[model samples]
Every structure is written in structure tokens, then in C-alpha cells.
Target: ASSRDGYSWTEKQGLKSGVPCIGTIQPPTNLDRASTEVFDVIVVGAGYCGLTAARDLTTSGILVADNPGSRLGLRTLLIEARDRIGGRSWSSDIDGYSFELGGTWIFWGQANVWREILRYQMQDELVSSYDFSKGLNKYILVNTERAQHFTHEEEDEMMESGLRKLVNVDGEYGKRVIPFPHTAAFTAEALRYDKMSVADRLSEIKDSLTPNELSGVEAFVLLCSGGTLETTSFFEFLHWWALSDYSYQGCIDYLVKYKFRGGQSSFAIRFFREALASGNLSYAFNSPVAEIDDTKDFVTVSTRDGKQYRAKRVISAIPLQVMNNVVFNPPLPSGKRTAASIGHVNQCVKVHAEVRNKDLRSYTGIARPENGLFYAFGDGTTPAGNTHIVAFGGQNGHFDPEDNIGTTARKLQGLVPMDIERLVFHNWSKDEFAKGAWFFSQPGLLSNHLGDMRARHGKVIFGSSDWALGWRSFIDGAIEEGTRAALTARTDLAPSQLKGKL
Candidate 1:
């Protein structure tokens, strides 16, 4: 049951497993034949990264002829540990309301994901989760002992002012450091301040900010750093600042404003469907890769059941923390191993709750990182007209949504003052395949290990949102890395096969 369902719900004392929109459905594949034949490229992890790579590699144009050797195009095999496709970016329907259990939200600024959205004609599916620019909604800020009401404008001002002080490391607001965030070409500038943590920077700017301003900044840090400010990198925050156009509003709008109306699962499934349509693609679900051995010419991927699949090139798209589970023959570099051991500092848990309050329907709740519930907002209303609120917190925080359901509900109510009905979430931190939620680089990570994290180990090409150049830790970043990995594999393939717009 755990293998089949990606989400769990807690209506009572313990969590009861529930199905995601796409995880339970298995796609048809010829894994037996796939194992017998050597593939041109093997993609591990059927998340957005692997799926995008498969799609691009398979559709790169093929030459057909009577002779088998005359045929062109990369034969791609995608292997997934779970029965589902999307790794952490999947959606579930709870009480007739769509809940994005993992990576959700996108914007026009995210080039790779936005391009795919346009290509798939899913632009119409995009919807704003909430528009803070309008100043129409109620915002609850709980930085002090009690919750206080503030208009969206007031909240924005405090946050904007506080962030200005926090991210302006070079007085140009990180521009001097990270002029091109996607390129990550700021090593020298970043190294100078690589040792500083988000907590350190916040402490430096706290005296300059008002109590409310400091509260807002702390909440932003908690949310952005995934509740680990003391270890989360200031350079990582600077990268985000540059990626978000160097504004607090841009960070909010780009990171959390927009999402697909049909849910991210539907969007992710489209890539799978398109990849499957290409005759060059095959896949195996429920096949967890135990080891990857890169010999002189080819790489052999061995699943837990001892089945081996050989490929000229392999794209390892799994998360950094999860990578420690898979053994490499020659072994990864010491830097990469150490980086994976440290991992990203995001042990934050995301929880979605349905509430029966009309007045609090579209409100945004912000709290101090230590307060347990760091950030939350009314995502949407259910068919029953109940408001659906999505909240995030640290794993060791006061709100234990996965356990102690009564206490979690009461704690949430203390923040938003709503009558809770149901709660749904996935514990990515505890999941074997994930081990953590979205990646937020730790101090000295970008300066010391970014290259090692993204570098290829012989024929095994590494691609993951965790190490993407631009939108790291986003669906867009997955596509960026996936597309790059596919193109890299294609370069090694026969030049005749690469005729399409890969």
C-alpha cells in the first residue's frame, strides 16, 4: 500500500493512506524485453527530469530502413522505483479539492517549464494561487505570542523592507555576486560570503527592521530556507533573489503564485504520455535501481531484484539524499559523497487542511520559524465550499501533522482560527526515495560542491532539480537539467539521429 499510494490522510488519530491522481496507475511496458536488449540511454527516476529526457531523446528523429543497424534515434529506457511517474511533484484529490502534495506552482519567468506549458498548450490551465498585488485578502502574521491581522499591502511592505536588508550583501542586492543565476557563474563573489548562513544575515539585519518587519523576514527565511536558517546558505538565498528578479514580491509571485488548474500530476503525465508515444521509448515501473556500474564503454544499471540493463549513457535524476542509497561501482567523488551526506537542509513538511470558514477563505498565514507552522495560505475551496489551506513547517516543529493529529489541528487553528475538517500530506522527509522535500543549498554548498553535484561520473550523466543551474529545486529546474542531460546523451549518440529540436 505504501508503494502504491503517495499520500496519506489523517481524519482521526493515525494517518490512513490515500491514492494520488497518477501514482497508482501503472503504464504498460515490456521490461522483460527491455532487460534483454541494450538501450542507447537509460534514465533512472521517472520524475520530471527522467520523463523530459526520455521524451527529448526519443523524439530526436529516427531513420528507418530495412536493416536494423540503419535505424536512428536513441532507444531510451526509463526506470522508476515507484509505481508512479512524478517523484515529489504530484497532486491528490482530497474531499473533492486538489492538493499538490509536493512541488507545485510555476510562473512565466520559469523558462523551461513555461516553454513546455506552451508546447503542450497547457497555458490555459495556469491559474494564480493567490494575487498579493491586489491587496484584497486578509493576512495573519503570528511572529509574536499571538496572531495579528494585516492587509496584504501592509504585509508586503514589511517583507519587502526586511528582505532588502537581508539580501543586499554587495549593496547591489546580490547582482554583483550572482549576475547570472542560471549560469551559476559567481563562484569568486559567492565564496567571499559562502560561510554566512541565512540566520547570520537575518541577525545582522534584525536591528534595522521593526518588530513586524523582522517577523516577516524571519517567516520568509523559514519558508525559503525550509525551516533551517542556521544551516541554509546565504549564497543560496542570493541565487533565489537573483532568480526572482531581486524583489520580495517577485519571490512570492514567481515561487508560489501560479499553478496548473488541473493539478501538477496531470501536467507531469502529459510528458509521460508523449514519451510513450515515441516508438524509441520503454519503461519499467516498480524497478528500484540498486547499483550503477560504469565500465569502459557502457553503464550497467542493476535493480534490487538483480535484473541488469546496459546503456551507453545513463541519466541519474534522483535527489541528492536519495542517491546515497544507490551504489556506484567506481564510487562518486568524495565531494559529492560529502555533499549528499549533508544534503539540502529542507526537512520541512507540507500539509493541506480543509476548513469550514468563509471569512478566512483566501487568507495567508505567516508565522515565525520556531512557531511550528511557518507559512500557509488558502489554496482554494472545495466542491462543498470548504476552504482548502496549505501549510508548511519543520519536521521537529510543534505541529506534527503526520502524528498527533489533534495537537496538529489545534496548533493550526491557533494560527488561522479555522474549523478544520480534513488534513492531507506526504512526508517527503521520511520517504525512502525522497528523504527530503525541495532542495535549498546549505552554506558553502554552491561554492564548494555545485560542480561536483552536477558533474557526470563516466557514462552516468547526473541531472536533478537539486543541481539545476537556474531554477534549482523547482519543476522548471527539473526540465532544465533533464533537457540538458538528454542533449548530452544525444551528443554521444550517432550524429545522424539528432535532427530534431532537442
Candidate 2:
């Protein structure tokens, strides 16, 4: 079902000819079993959170051996449902060009987690875009004849206005509107937008916007949220706004400076290779975890294959929605269980196309009434001496890759000269490993479940971008959660100061 190294099919002549490649042999059946008997930590999921957790825990002065030492060397296990290492972050070669299929782009201002990527020396491979201040040309397709260009100042004003509204409501800036679940300033800020959809919010400002301005704003909402205002939560929009400094200007500035030069997948691959080299990490691929038993002192994890792994501590980095399917022996608390049942954002499908054109350098955001394809922009350089463009369609509706590829291309064709060669699309809905791109707080759901959903269950800790308070859907959030969870685990395992019995 997955394409490797591009192209639809490749010949496997070696198997038929009975010729063996060097160092190629049958994988051991006991591969899932660690070379050692037990591990200090068993991390389920090999995504950013899981990998970073394993790496940090292992390298710390902790001694991980038959007998625990002064600083426990962390023995970690990472399990992935897919054949590849990256959970949602993935990249592959298509038409001789590197294309990111999942999450891409990192903002420079994302201090804590993103700084790790730079400290680890990954920035060179991940390129930043052209200057955002120069005001990259933007075009909007308001039906056929309505296509118009937006000036940089116009775009900046629109973004600033949106952010200003998000943070300020009823003459209050950065105030908490909701107080039931938790009393916090951001919560109030989040509550102001909670009742309205992105579309509904925009309608209030329609009178102030020109025809082109309205269309551009509509497109920006759809593209950024990955769904129409009708489907996207106002709180979620505010959350993103907060993550990007409460301004569209800040968001674009971060986007232009923060991105994977070689693509996010490169970081994933490097992490995987590094984990393997550590010789302390073992993994089970294509194996979906079915159950987790935390009744005993040690946590036991059972995969669909019926194989079990027992460890002192467990980390569930899987998306909240998927976690509901895995049975927990003691049964998760009502709140945590309810949070999982609430599920993630709607299904998302991303399309990448390589066209015969180089002049198309700027990113394009289009908002169409009939079809709001979230966001589409020129992504990378193609092998065919052209530009690679990508589109993100969120849960609002579905678009057939084959049927709509022509239409999407034509829309872009009007803006820039290009001959579409081939198209690549990934339906995350159809993907068993990931049911959706990212998690979203539905109306009335965050108030009811955000806290309990993040609470730890016994020795098991849950960490993912979805559970993060800030930058919920970004890699920075994932790393922040990973670091936080690791610290929690480390603290819990520390020896009690008052060991003697009274």
C-alpha cells in the first residue's frame, strides 16, 4: 500500500533467481524479544515523542543493566505500527524529488523543543524559506474571474486583526473565559473563541473586508486549520494563534525560518538510525498494540500478534483516538477513557504534485466556496526542472486524487505557468496506523476532558503533540511532552528519601 523510493512497482528478480544479497538474511522470529531480559522503560510508538524519550532516557547517567546502578542506564523499547520509523512525519522520493507526505515545517521561535533539533545539528539539512518580510506574492481563487493578488501589507493586517480578536474579547486581552475545569488566563482566552467556528467568526468581520480580502481570509482559515470554520473549533484556532505568537505576522515569520531543509522525514530516519546504533532499543514494526496490563508492579504490553513485553514503566505515545482500542486491564478512569472516545480532528488528505514550471516560487493559499482545499503552496524543487506543489484537505470533505487533480492543477495553472506531470496523495483516514493528521479539541470537549486525558495511569505516562498545552500539533510540542514525561518517569523511579520503617 506504501510507495518506496517512488514509482508504483519494482521487480524482485533476486528472489526468483535464488541470488542472495550481502548481509541479507531471514529476520529472526524472536526479533521482538530484547537481547536482554527486561527494560527500564517500554515506549510504545516510534514517533517524535517516543524516540526523543528513549534517546534522552538512555543517554542520561542512568545505568540500565541486570541490576540497576546509581544512575539507571535506561533500557528503552520503541514499537511502531508502520514498517517505517516515523509515525506521522514521513518523506519519500517521488519523481526524483524529496516530498514530505506528513508533517513538515518548524518555526524558528519554537524555543524549547525545536532548539534541540538545532543543538543536535539538524538545521543545515532543513532549509528555511525566503524572507517573509519581503512579502511573498499571494493569489486567491474566488471562483473563475475573481482571482486577485494580495499585497504584503494587506495580508499582514488581516493576520494581525485575526490574532487581536483571538486574544482580546469583551475589552479583555489574554483573559480566561472558561473557569469550570481549570482556572487559567489562557483558558479564558481559549473560551472566547470556543463558541464560534472559524467561519462564524469571519462572518462578523465580513462588512469590514473587501471582496478579495474576504476571500483571502476565508482561504487562510481553511488552509491553516485544515478544515472550514464550520468544522474547525474557535478554541483550536486560538491555540494555534497563541503557539505562533498571537499574530499571523509572527506565524509566517516562524514558518519562513523554521522548516526541515532535507524534510522532517530526514530527522525521523536519523533518530531511528541513532536508536538502533545505541543497541539498547528494540522495536516491533507492523505490530499493532492490542492490550496493556498495569495491574501488576511491572506493566505488560500485548500486541495483536499475542506477543507480550513487560517493563517497569510504559509510555503510550499513540494518538488519543487509537488508544481507546487498546484494552487496559484495570480499565482507564472515566475521564481518560472519555477523552480517548472523543477522538481526534477529522480525516485529512494531502496531495503533492510535480509540475513543469520553475517560476512559481511563492506559497499560494486558495479559498473556494465549493471546495476549500485548506492550503496549497509550492513546496520543493522537482527533478524535472520544475516546482513541487502540495495541498492539504482537511475533514470538511473528501476529494478524489484522480478526479480532482486536474481541477487543482488548472486552478494553479491560472496563477502560475506549469504543466502537471503526476500527482501524489495520502489519505490519512485510510491509514490504520493513524486515523487522522492531528488531534483537536471539539466543542465542550476540552473543558470536560483535557486534564484527566493527560493524567498518568499508574506507571504508564501518555505524551504526544495532542496532549500538549501549547503547540499541540507541532513537533515542538511533541518534544516538550517527551521531555516532561521522561522527567516524570525519572522522578517516580527515584529512591525514597525516607526509606526506614517507622
| Cα-based TM-score, every candidate | 0.92, 0.83
Off by over 4 Å in 2: 1-36, 63-68, 130-138, 151-154, 157-189, 255-257, 372-374, 400-417, 496-502
lDDT minimum window of 10 residues, candidate 1: 61-70
Q: Which ten residues in a row have the lowest lDDT in candidate 2?
A: 14-23
**What is the lDDT of every predicted structure here?**
0.80, 0.62
Task: Please name the candidate that would achieve the greatest TM-score relative to the true structure.
Answer: 1
lDDT of 1 by residue, 353-400 (tens): 887775566689787646577788878767987777888787436344
Q: Estimate the Cα RMSD of every predicted model relative to the unseen true structure.
A: 3.5, 5.7
Per-residue lDDT of candidate 2, residues 316-427 (tens digit): 8888868888899888999988888877665666766666656454656564554535456667666566666676666665554444445655544544445666665555
